[model samples]
Target chain A: MRQLIVFTLAILVSTTFKVYSQEIRIVNYDQLDKLVSSTKDSVVVVNFWATTCKPCLEELPYFAEAGKVNKNEPVKFLFVSMDFTSKKEKAAEVFSKYNLPGKCVLLSENPNNWINKFNPQWGGDIPYTFLQDKKGNRTHYPKTFATSEELINLIKKELIKQ
Target chain B: MKHLLAILFLFIVSISIAQTTGYKPGDKAIDFSLKNIDGKNVSLKNYNDAKGYIVVFTCNHCPYAKAYESRIEELNQKYASKGYPVIAINPNDPVAYPEDSYENMQKNAAEKHFTFPYLLDETQNVAKTYGALKTPHVYILKKVNNELIVKYVGAIDDNTESAKDVKKKYAENALNELLQDKTVKEPETKAIGCGIKWKKN
Candidate 1:
């Protein structure tokens, strides 16, 4: 009887470990919609990045740090990786390697139309950023990564307006 | 009648000078000695036996270029034997992205077994001269009557990812046109690639 119980316990532990280790699939547009809707009271910071883009890689840590610092606040950070489908698995490896945080997701959509759907102001550039307030008022900053101070000031200004 | 003839002559001279801003169709491309991955000079004039050149602006790290690496190699293999060889140039500032560093360029070349010379544009002068905006951008030139004239300038194809989905092959068609002495059907097209990471001011 004790052997049976031990086996069962081991099975449960291994199952839970497997579940936790599974890579999260964030390609669903529905998930993104839900995130935006639920975080309506807070500001949403969306950063478009890719595993191969060096500027995107450099700026991601700043967003991660920003999320941690604002853990007690109402800011919702999303790191949308723009890596191609062919590189999806590779991107996952890179994400784990970097120990990325703050809701990492791989963008899944027809890439040709993605830029227009996201923001017309965006020039289809990597490391692009979009900020949305609780009211759904959106502002797109279509460029490379921002310095910590630049990021902080932008957030502070948004918070002040709120 | 004499005054009208002089005016016509002056207008022709003005048009000729305006057309010489850089290389155009039917212009002999001036050769330049540029450093390659091995720190050795590679010049267009080196291929004395070649009929023309295919100058492509590409780099080691851009996703678009990475996607088209094999296809570009295929082009070099197919055409180099036919006389028009590919001469690739890396125009991105190495300071902005270390992977674009000359060291990484050599590494990428060896690892990928690149068939053509991958030259570095030290000052981005060549890129500026050609108005190349993105990686994998192509400029096909041919020597017609001893003048290096631009045959075509654009993306390799309409689809950067795959030929299966390609609606058109710009470079291939241009080469075919050049071979037949016919005007390229599509002379220019936009390319999608990583933006050249210029050093921040």
Candidate 2:
């Protein structure tokens, strides 16, 4: 009886840990495209950030809060990390530490080849947020520090217009 | 009426912010006197004898900037004698990022043995005027008949990760073209680097 109880407790703990530990998806451009195109008639907030960027860290919580607030809304938040492939572990650790909401993925694409694809005028800087509509058409791509309210308002404006 | 005025004011502010998205190719470079690491003020006008200038907006803490430090030094070593001297500047706010402070700039200049004038853009006007979005951003300005012309604006090369892997030396090529009295083939290119730490309003 004692052995059975111990085995059951161990099994429960392992399962709980496995469920709680969210795996950070390491994705190429093709995978990123798939994720961006997954949902229809939804406002997607694709935030390009990294562990090394201080401004990114400062605003990420606010961004997470925005995601949580708009959970029921026709909004989808994607935290795409621009950290190097070598810092995959570090990026994952930061993601967990921040408890960043929604789908979290590390983009492994070489920026030189794809920076302009996202936006022609994009200078490949962090703390950049790309707000897109249901059809994957970009509504706003602010390449600077943006507050949660500003992000939400942008989304709302787009949603109303569309 | 008050609400309408507030909305109008907000609209104007937004318009101004949109206007600051920064300099494109062919825009005349804004000249300013920024303090160099050597405790002397430097300006584009000071380089009257030079044919052109390789203005690089970079900082200490940025890994990409550090990566290109050697290449920047070599650029100065080769070009400063050849009329197109490298003029590096730190356009980041020190309070937002302490590593970008003037003192750190001096230390970095000494430690790295930089041959060019490493200036501190305290106001960041020069950087904004040039549309410098990231560290290690380059703007190759040519001196033509006492007027400065923005010949090229872009990255030092295609690869910022490794200097050896650089296939296209964009800035170098532009300078070479200028030296040969020819038009620069590519006017602008983008690079991946740390964003310039702007001070809060």
Candidate 3:
């Protein structure tokens, strides 16, 4: 009886871990747009990154650290992986490796259709960051963050505006 | 006074953001003389019989560029005879990415069997003037009355991951339309790609 109970517990743990690791959602452009624009009473930090981009890999940890530091604040982090839909598993693996504090989604659609919708000024560069305050004022940073402090500071500034 | 200063700062930021300073469709593109992998300077004027050029700002390192390498080669094969030869330019700073160095570019082209002239934008001035911000950025120019008119600007296609999955061949469609003497319906497009590495001042 005890052996069966132990086996059941192990299965539960493994299944939960599997589910958590595969939690990276694959979203189309419209779904991503809704997710970003529909956030209520919170500052949204949407980071565009790819597994193949070197600078993106280098700076992801900073965003993850920033997310942890601002856990108490009303800021939400959304990692938008620009990886090909075929490489969704690799993207999920990278996302899990960071132990990121918020949701990670693979944006599976032609960027040509929606890049201007996010920011016409953005020339489709990865490591791009889009920040929105509670009132919907948006800021675009088309470069990598040097540290978690830089990200946290930006979030703080946005929070105070509300 | 603080509020006034803030407003002034915002205005400056907006101005910087809005400054595009790049070529748009119908704009006449300037010809450039850049060093090709063959150690010879290649100028658009050299191609007297050509109808136009497919100026691709690509590099050795970017995966998005690599993914479309074969397609770019195919474009050169399919259109070079028809007069629109692909002129690939590596625009990244080698100091930031050693993989984008001229030596590696030669190796990449050799390995990929690229028929196009892979040039190095050594000063990066050409890329800046054309307003190319990312690797794999493309500007299709049409020769009209001795001037190179910018016809299309953007990605090679709608899909970057799989060539077989591509539904809209953006660059090829523009080329076809140009060949048929029709106005390109979609003049511009955008795609997520590796940002071109610029030299630090």
| Top-scoring candidate (DockQ) | 3
Candidate ordering by TM-score (highest first): 3, 2, 1
- Which numbered prediction scores highest in TM-score against the true structure? 3
Q: What is the TM-score of chain B alone in each candidate?
A: 0.83, 0.90, 0.90
- Tell me which residue pairs clash in candidate 2: none
TM-score, candidate number 1: 0.63
Question: Where does model 3 exceed 4 Å of error?
Answer: A1-10, B1-21
Off by over 4 Å in 1: A1-41, A96-101, A108-110, A116-125, B1-55, B62-64, B78-85, B95-99, B103-115, B128-134, B137-195
Candidate 1 on B1-201: residue-level lDDT in tens?
Answer: 999999999999976654433444444455667899888999887898888888988898798788888888889999998888999999999988788889999999999999999999988767756656568778898876666777776678766556577767789888878778788877655444676676555
As for candidate 1, its clashing pairs are: B27-B148, B28-B148
lDDT of 2 by residue, A1-162 (tens): 999999999999999887556667789877887888776798888888888888888888877777777878888888888776667778888887886667689887556567677677677777788777877787546565467787678778767765
Q: Estimate candidate 3's alpha-carbon lDDT, on a 0 to 1 scale.
A: 0.90
| Cα deviation of A19, candidate 1, in Å | 3.9
Residue-level error in angstroms, candidate 2, position B51: 1.4
Task: Please report the candidate that would top lDDT against the real structure.
Answer: 3
- Residues A1-162, candidate 1: write the lDDT tens digits: 999999999999999987556454657555665666577778888877778788788877777677666778778877777676677677777777665545667766544334445554333446778788878777777666567667756766676665
Q: Model 2 interface RMSD, in angstroms?
A: 1.8
